[model samples]
Target: MPGIGPLLGAEFLAATSGDMSLFGSADRLATYAGPAPTPHDSGRVSGNLHRPTRYHRGLQRVFYMSAMSSIHFCPESRRFYQRKRSEGKRHTQAVLALARRRVNVLWALLRDGRRFEPAQPATGTA
Candidate 1:
């Protein structure tokens, strides 16, 4: 929500058909959006993951663009992106990870009908 603008928001709504019920869960939505990789494992070739072959590119673009914009506008997003980079992820991979996380948040918000609220930093008292 922090990174989503008018156009991206409209695109997301159109992609999702304005109904969370169709997805049933955030994982499902992510899969549809192409952020959730599919396994290409066979016997000894385990841990092999690849992009899904059939996903809504428009939806993926919506999430990817929002994730990229969030890195500059949202502190939490920046930190997450930095952490992913530290963990050996490339820029695109980090952004995709953030996008997947955002999908979960968006799904929860839609399911609960709540607004996005940034977490408050904790203060230490002497």
Candidate 2:
């Protein structure tokens, strides 16, 4: 667990390591990552968006586990968590959003068959 952090984890990579062809594209990646929420109709009531995986538990666990660490070890993740809290999102909601964001980035990488782009330093008036 040394130097290992969330928002990216061994689990995520292992879950995604097989069959790039199975993903097909980035949008499909979104769906696979549990970011693509489902239509929740509550018996003549409105709907909501959330995860529901009867199948991809390992994959979901990857994101969730990563999320758990990201809040503690990642600056950007911490910032996002703070921002979401300020915006009135509950702690879980904030974390879920962060996980989905990471999923999108991973999706882009998968789409291009490329490794992750390193975190670029912020450029400002120096």
The prediction achieving the highest TM-score against the true structure is: 1
Deviation in Å, model 2, residue 34 alpha carbon? 2.6
Please provide, for model 1 over 4-69, each residue's C-alpha lDDT reduced to its tens digit, 9 standing for 90 to 100. 999999999999999889988988998899856668999899989897579999999999999999
Query: In candidate 2, where is summed lDDT lowest over 10 consecutive residues?
Result: 1-10
Query: What's the lDDT for residue 85 in model 2?
Result: 89
What C-alpha lDDT do the candidate models reach, one value each? 0.91, 0.68
Tens-place lDDT per residue, model 2, 1-126, is 211345345666677786667787755655676655678878877776556654466776676667668788777777877999899999888878877776667667666778755467698977
Candidate 1: where is the Cα deviation over 4 Å? 35-50
**How high is each candidate's TM-score?**
0.88, 0.67
